[model samples]
Target: YLKKIGRRGKIDIWLVDGAKIRRDLEKDFTNFAEYYYFPIIPKYEFWIDRESVPNERRFFIDHLLAEWRLMDGGMSYQRAKEIANQKELSERKKAGDLEKVINQKSEFSPEKVHRRLLDKTKDEIDIWLVDGRLVRSAFDIGFTEGGHDLVYQYVPKNEVWIDDDVFAKERPYVLLHELYERSLMKSGLTYLRAHRKASRLEWRARHSEQILDEFFLKFLIKKGKI
Candidate 1:
């Protein structure tokens, strides 16, 4: 649930209980420390996950504000996010607590999954846990915690990948997001549309565990595995 903390200039700041969010969503590395959406409030509302330490909170806030402004100025979200990430990276480096990890993984190497498969049903799609950091380093640097075949490189034709970095409690939410996004794409939704809807579902899942149960149930029903 979101609690209004205060106003930041013209934007409303809300605090999210990130642990509860993780527990409710059943995901590990969903990795959204802060985010903002337009028209959800008067102009924009900024949300920060309470899981962030005090020293890290301001950096996330700075990133959100920068991202919001860039998007407001007609910049693409991808470009804006890249710039914001760079900004945050620079800030963290300045704080002297940032250590860039060197990825030694190979692109074509057979990576092991944390588990065999999320569900083994009649459906052809297979979901597996993967080293998301390695994937990002060797395959696509833009790779996040969750990804699937349609919009990503290196993924097989009918597979969903969950980052092994995600917490055991939160893996389910990330799986839900990847599965929903893939389903929407297969149903002919554009990647952008499908991604937006999936992102919203992920957000809702963060707030309510019931949503997770209902979504998984629907998924099982669709797979005829119920």
Candidate 2:
């Protein structure tokens, strides 16, 4: 469902709801933010996921607009994406939440030493901070900077992978999503199903208090373990 929420200059801002069709159709709509230009309709649109974190929505919008402006100005996608990414990261840092971690190596060597063992739930899940560039090069996945066992890649069968580029403050939110998704998958849910559930929980965590406690409580409620 794409609803026009507002307008910016000549572009239309839309809120996209993938909850209804995400699992079955797996439409290329599983995106936090995207921009589209319908020349036939003579319209320009920027679509943001309806469930995105309230705090980060503006960042996503800014990034998309920046990228679109550059692309519309004849810049290549690669160049535009890199420029937009850096700008977005800069804004996130200004928000005082983008804590960056430095990695010693440049290649795709999954470093377990820097891995974190999270005991948030009863399960002990390993989370490795990997190079986003390396991951993108090695795998043809569309993930911006996160992955789990759902895709057969680096790390063990039960580990989650986060981009080292992710800031310290935002890491927990990504970790929360990955861990919740893994838990649901382990409980016999399909990858898409689990992913959507995790995304919802991540949203809740960003807006509410005691995020970890809230996450566990909701999971338990879903499993009737409460």
TM-score of each: 0.53, 0.47
Give model 1's clash tally: 8
Number of the top candidate by lDDT?
1
Q: Which candidate comes out best when scored by TM-score?
A: 1
Model 2 poorest ten-residue lDDT run: 34-43
TM-score, candidate number 1? 0.53
**Cα lDDT of model 2 by residue, 1-226, tens digit:** 4787777788887776543333233323444444433221223777665542334566667778888899788888788878887777667667644223323564434442234443323454556665553343334224554678665565556567765545555566666787778878878999889988888877666666587566656533221211
Q: Candidate 2 at 45: error in angstroms? A: 9.9
What TM-score, to 2 decimals, does candidate 2 have?
A: 0.47
Candidate 1 structure quality by residue, lDDT tens digits, 1-226: 4677667788887776555644454334233433334332345577565532233556667777788889888888889888987776666557543122332552254243334465632366777766654454445545656788888856877888876655556667777788889889989999999988987898788788789888877766232221
